[model samples]
Target: MERAVRWDRLREEMAREGVELLALVPGANLFYLTGLHFHRMERPIVALLPREGEPALILPAFEVEKAQRAPIPWRLFPYTDAEGPASAFHAAAAALGGRGHTIAVETLGMRVLEWSLLAEAFESPTPLPAEPLLARLRMVKGPEEIAAIRRAIAAAEAALQQWLPEVRPGMTEREATRRLIQACFAAGADALAFEPIVVAGPNAALPHATPSERPMGPGEMMIVDFGVIMDGYVSDLTRTFVLGEPDPETARIYEVVREANAAGRAAVRPGIPAEAVDRAARAVIEAAGYGPYFPHRTGHGLGLEIHEPPYLVQGDRTLLTPGMVFTVEPGIYLPGRGGVRIEDVVVVTETGGESLTTFPRELRSL
Candidate 1:
C-alpha cells in the first residue's frame, strides 16, 4: 500500500507535467516502482506506466512470477529469449496507446537498445526527459525513506568506529580498503555503496581515487570515503584522518574544509534555492583562497542512487523543500600534495537542516 502511494504520487507528478506515459528500463526508477531488481543485461526489461490505465510490466518470461508479488497490479507482458522483446514492447505500446502521446523516459539510464525498441514500438515517438518529473516525485523523501537512510548511516559509522582503531602505520591503502569492507559487513551492511576510496597522502588528491599499494606511514593523513547500503537506501560519509600527528598546513586545511561543510549544512532550509547551500559552502573555501582546488559541487541529492537531483552547485535554482536529503561535502585538494574533505548527509526540515551523518567531524589521529 505504501508503494502504491508512491506510484500515485508519480502519477500526480506526471499529470502535472503533461506526461501521458513513463517508459523505464532496468534501473533505480524501475526498482523503485516495482521493488524488483534486474541486473542490466543485453536482454531488455521495460516498464510502461500510463497515467490513466493499468501499468504494464514487460520483462523476461522468467521474471513474470516476481511481478505477481508487486504491491500494485501490473499488466504483464513477458517475453522468452527465443521470442525476443519486440512483441512485448509492441503489445505494451498497443495496450497503453503510445502514438502521439507525451511519453517520458530516463534519458541517462535507458540504453540505446531500449530506446530503439521504444521508438519502433511507439512509431518513433520522441520521449521527453523524465528526470524533472521523477525528481519532483523523488527528491523530498518521506519518513520511512529517511529512516532507511539512517540505518545505512548507522552501519557505515559503526564500521568506521570499529575499523579506525585497528589502523596500523604500515598497511597499504588496498589493505586498508579490504579491512574496511569486512568491517562494513560485520557491522550489518547489506552491501557497499561504492568501492571504498581509501587513499593516503598524495593519492588523496584525487576525489575518486582508487586504492593503491602505497603504505601509509605515521605523520601522514588518509582520506576514507565510504558508505553502506541498508533498507534499499545508501549513506555517503567521508572523513580525513591522521596516523599520529598532522603537519600544520594539513591541519589548517582540514579545519577549513570542516567549516565549509558546516556552512553548507547550515544553509539548508525550506524555500531557499538549492544553490544557496553551494554558495554558502564555497564562500568559506574561497575566502580561504582554496577555491581553485575545490573542483566538484558542494554536494548532491542522495537516496535511491548515489547521485540524483537538486544538485548543490551554481545555477541550480531548485528550491529546497522539507524532506529533501543531500550531502554537504567540501574539499581542498592540492594537485601534488594531500587533500582534506569532510562530507555529511543532511535533510531539509521545516526549521532547518538535520544531519543524518553523526560520526565525529573532529580531526583525530589514529
Candidate 2:
C-alpha cells in the first residue's frame, strides 16, 4: 500500500508536469517504487509508469518472478535472449498509449540503449527530465527510511569501533581498509556505501584519496572515510586521526575544521535555506584563514543514494524541512601536509537537527 501511494503521487506529479508517462531503468527509483533491484546488464529492464492505468515492466524472462513480487500491480512484458527486448518494449509502449506521448525519464540514470529502445517503441516520443519530480519525492524521508539509515549508521560506527583498536603504526592503508570492511560486514552491514578511503600523511590532502600501500606512521595524520549500507539506506562518515602527537599547525587546523563541522550541524533546522548551513560552516574556516583549502560543499543528502538533493552548498536555496537527512562535513587541507575532515549524518526535526553518527569527533591518537 505504501508503494502504491508513492506511485500514485508520482503519477499526479507527472500529470501536473505535462508528462503522460515516466520511465525508469534499473536504479534507485525503480527500487523505490517496486522494492526490487535489477543489475545493469546487456539486456535492459525498464519500467513505464503512466499517469493513469496500470504500470508496465519490460524485462528479461528470468526476472518475471521478481516483477510479480512487486508491491503494486504492474503489467509484465517479459522477453527472452533470442527474442530480444523489442517486443516487450513495444508491448509496454502500446499499453501506455503509444506514439507521441510525453515521457519523463531520469536523465542522469537512463542509458542510451534504453533511450534508443524507447525511441524505437514510441513514435516521436517527447522526452522530459524527471529529476526535479523525483528529487522532491525523495528529499523528505519517511519513518521507515529514517530507521534504516539509523541502522546503517550504527553498523558503521560499530565497525569502526571494532577496527580502531587493531590499528598499528606499521599497518598499510589497504590493510586497515580491509579490516574495516570485514568489521562492517560482521556488524551486520548489508554492503558498503563505497570503497573505504584511508589516506595518511601527504595523501590525506586529497579529498577523495584512495587507500594506498603507504604505511601509517607516527607523528602524522590519517583520514579514514567510510560508510555502511543497511536495508538499502546508507551512512557516510569521515574522521581524521593522529598516530601520536601532532604538530602545532596540524592540531590548529583540526580544531578549525571541527568547529566548522559543528557550526554546519547547528545551522540545520526546519525552514532555513540549505545554503545557510554551508555559509555557517564556511565562515568558520574562512575566519581561521583556510577558506580556499576548504573546497567542496559542506555535505549532501543521504539515503538510497549516497548523494542526493538538499545539498549544503553556496547558492542552493532549498529549504531544510523535517525528515530530511544529510551530512555535515567540513575540512581543511594544506598541500604537502595533511587534512582534517569531521563528518556526521544528521536528520532535520521540527525543533532542530539530530545527528545519527555519534562516533567521537575529538581527535583520536592510535
Q: Pick the candidate with the highest TM-score.
A: 2
Candidate 2 worst ten-residue window by lDDT: 1-10
lDDT of 2 by residue, 149-227 (tens): 9999999999999999998788999999999999999999999999999888888999999989999888789999999
RMSD value for candidate 1: 1.2
**lDDT (0 to 1) per candidate:** 0.91, 0.92
* Candidate 2 local lDDT, residue 299: 94
User: Which 10-residue window of candidate 1 scores lowest in summed lDDT?
Assistant: 94-103
Candidate 2 differs from the real structure by a C-alpha RMSD in angstroms, to one decimal, of: 1.0
lDDT of 1: 0.91
TM-score (all chains, Cα) for each model: 0.97, 0.98
Candidate 1 lDDT over 239-348, as tens digits, reads: 99988899999999999999999999988999999899999999999999999999999999999888998899999999999999999999999986888999999999
> Which stretches in model 2 have alpha-carbon errors above 4 Å?
none
Q: Using alpha carbons, what is the TM-score of model 1?
A: 0.97
TM-score for candidate 2: 0.98
